[model samples]
Target: MNKFAALCLILCAAPANAHPHIFINAGLVFVVDADNRLTHVQVTWEYDELYSLLVTEDMGIDADYDGVLSEADTARLTGFDMQWIEGYNGDLVGTLAGQNLTLSAPTAPTATLTEGKIVTTHLRAVSGAPQINGTLSFLPYDGTYYTAYDVTLPVLVQGGNGCEVTVDTPDIKGALSMTKAEIGALPEDFDMEAAGLGDIGRRFATDVRVTCAAL
Candidate 1:
């Protein structure tokens, strides 16, 4: 099975109380043109140490288990996480003025091992280069709640003068309460594979909003 399918199976099979298996610290850099149009978003993801270790071992990297990668190993690891199954959206949702924005597939991918963790970055172009006079927002999440993302890193609005970036964290207590209630209502023999819960992680996501002042 493809990586996405395998991830879904593993996550969907877990009990609702179980936490996300993979953790990522994510950041974004919004690239805008002189006309205040958003051209692309540079996204960064730093994998948790445990997940990084698993990936290295699975790929037979770092043969000596020294927690350090040689130049050849680093080259081999580049873009390792950029492989996306069809229609996977890269777990990032972008919107402008409450309307969904089309984002191109990840490009300019780069990856490195830092302190025994995998740090990767990629660029996603905005399909239309939409002008951002209003609000542009992004939410990083795994709909299955299998991978948790925390916007704990820098978020910048590059090349957009007077643009403000804000990150809003969700209400964890309330979200957890609602999620528990919904899961509790499921039938005893309900099949998650047949009918999956929709975007549960959306409730717990961190909102990254950018607003640019009119020239």
Candidate 2:
């Protein structure tokens, strides 16, 4: 099956109690134009050691098993994750003033092996170049909760004056309580396939908010 179809099956089969198999430390750099318009965002994903090992092994790279990549290996690994399937939002959601912002396809992909982990980055252009006045929010999450993302790295604003960036973590206790309540409300015979639990990750997502001084 194709990537999109496979993702559909994974989402359908995922239960409310499903835990993430892959973990990522994510970072974002908001790029603003001189006119104070939000133009692009550079996203970074650092994969965990286990996942990094798996990827290297699967690709038959890193022959020395030293957890370091050669130049050729880095070249081959670049854009490996950029082959995104249609209908996938790259696990990134952005909103400004309560309106969803359209993001262009990933570009300028780069990959490297650092300290036994895989680090990758790509840029996504904001389609309309919206003015940066009010608050802008972003969340990185996998709908099925199969891959967990944490804003553990630097969240920066580049080329924008008087802009402040902050990370607001979700209330884990409250989110867990709500999830339990929803699962408990389901009837004994309720079909798990119809549970619509794919969005459980959003409840625990870390919010990345940006606010710019009135411009």
Candidate number achieving the greatest lDDT relative to the actual structure: 1
| Model 2 agreement with the true structure over 59-111: per-residue lDDT tens digits | 98797998778889999999999999888899999999889999999999999
Looking at model 2, the pairs that clash are none
Q: What is the overall TM-score of model 1 with all chains considered together?
A: 0.88
Whole-model Cα lDDT of every candidate shown, in order = 0.84, 0.83
> Highest TM-score, which number?
1
Cα lDDT tens digits, model 1, 69-165, are 8898988898999889999999999999999999999999888888888999999999989999788999999987778899998999889778899
RMSD of each candidate relative to the true structure = 3.7, 4.3
Candidate 1: give its CA RMSD in angstroms: 3.7
Question: Which residue pairs show collisions in model 1?
Answer: none
RMSD of 2: 4.3
